[model samples]
Target chain A: EAGVAQSPRYKIIEKRQSVAFWCNPISGHATLYWYQQILGQGPKLLIQFQNNGVVDDSQLPKDRFSAERLKGVDSTLKIQPAKLEDSAVYLCASSSRQSSSGNTIYFGEGSWLTVV
Target chain B: QKEVEQDPGPLSVPEGAIVSLNCTYSNSAFQYFMWYRQYSRKGPELLMYTYSSGNKEDGRFTAQVDKSSKYISLFIRDSQPSDSATYLCAMRVQGGSEKLVFGKGMKLTVNP
Candidate 1:
């Protein structure tokens, strides 16, 4: 089975510029998530979607970051006026809500962003 | 204090040696525990997962959870160069939310 798919494996933008990342989760998975991993740190969740609805986004930077999972199969995360601190890897992951082990999430290769 | 705490180690060891990684969590509500391995410039991949408190083993990897102490550990046996990567421990509250709280991953290198 194919795993989660993400695009624009690498990206670089100047400070104050905008950037976006896309993700296509595994087939039939009902939950999708976006996380940010700064260099030398563990992944920090930015948002989570269960189908077309958001499950959680408390940690997201509301002023600069936003995400959407329209139609529930794919997702996009965007950051506007990107800052140097926003440089990190954007990871997309999915899990089957129907499975008993729903906590086992699978991640994509991630989109790397470097804001200069 | 952070919900989860893990030592960020860039530990290096000879091949075939045994390796141990650990994390401590402050939330007693966390019921699901997991370990993820990430290579350079790549996203994290699930390595092991356990529910509640107990021990689970897969191949050369073993995961142990001690709820009373709020500690979790991962042991790799006969470690190989391929095992070199950053390991992260994560956990979440059962029946609450699916959001996972992660630690500051520990980096390991197995030199041949």
Candidate 2:
């Protein structure tokens, strides 16, 4: 079985430019998530999707950030007018609704973003 | 105070030495505790998971949860240079939401 897949493993953009990252979760996983991990810090949840609908996005910067998971399978996270602080790794993860360990999530290699 | 607190250690230890990492959480609702290892420029991968308070061991890794003190620990036995990485502790509420609350993560380096 294949793990989660993400596109554009590394990205570099200007502070005001826009950037997008794509993710394709595991075939049967129903829960999808996007997280931002800055150097020296743990990942912070950006958005979460259950199937095609969003379950949580409380920490997402609504003004400059937008995400979508269409058809309950693939996801895309976008950052417009990116800030220098936006430079970090965008991690995509997925998990079965319930497992022996109560939803063990698997993460992709992540998209590393650098904003100048 | 942060919901989860951890010592962001850049701890260096020799190979074959025992390594211990810990975290304390303020939320009592978290029922599932986990540890994840992340290499530089890579995403985190799960190392251990435990529900409630107890110890769960997998090979060289051991995870312990103490709900009474709202504390958790991860122990690596006979550490190897390959074990060098950032370790993060995460927890979530049982039953409904799957969102994970993460700590700042601690960096460990084992000399060969």
Candidate 1 lDDT by residue in tens digits, B24-108: 9999999999999999878889899999999999999999999999999999999999999999999999875688999999999
Provide the lowest-lDDT 10-residue window in model 1 chain A: A95-104
Which lDDT tens digits does candidate 2 get at residues B3-64?
Answer: 99999998999999999999999999999999999998778999999999999999999999
Off by over 4 Å in 2: none
Candidate with best DockQ:
2
Question: What's candidate 2's DockQ score?
Answer: 0.81
Measured with C-alpha atoms, the lDDT of residue A80 in candidate 1 is 97
How far is A13's C-alpha from truth in model 1 (Å)? Answer: 0.3
The fnat scores of all predictions, in order, read: 0.73, 0.68
DockQ of 1: 0.78
Task: Output per-candidate TM-scores for chain A, rounded to 2 decimals.
Answer: 0.97, 0.98
Candidate 1 runs further than 4 Å off: none
Per-residue C-alpha lDDT of model 1 across residues A69-91, encoded as one tens digit per residue: 99989999999989999999999
Per-prediction DockQ comes to 0.78, 0.81
Tens digit per residue, CA lDDT, model 2, A1-116? 99999988999999999999999999999999999998888899999999999999999999999999989999999999899999999999999966566889999999999999
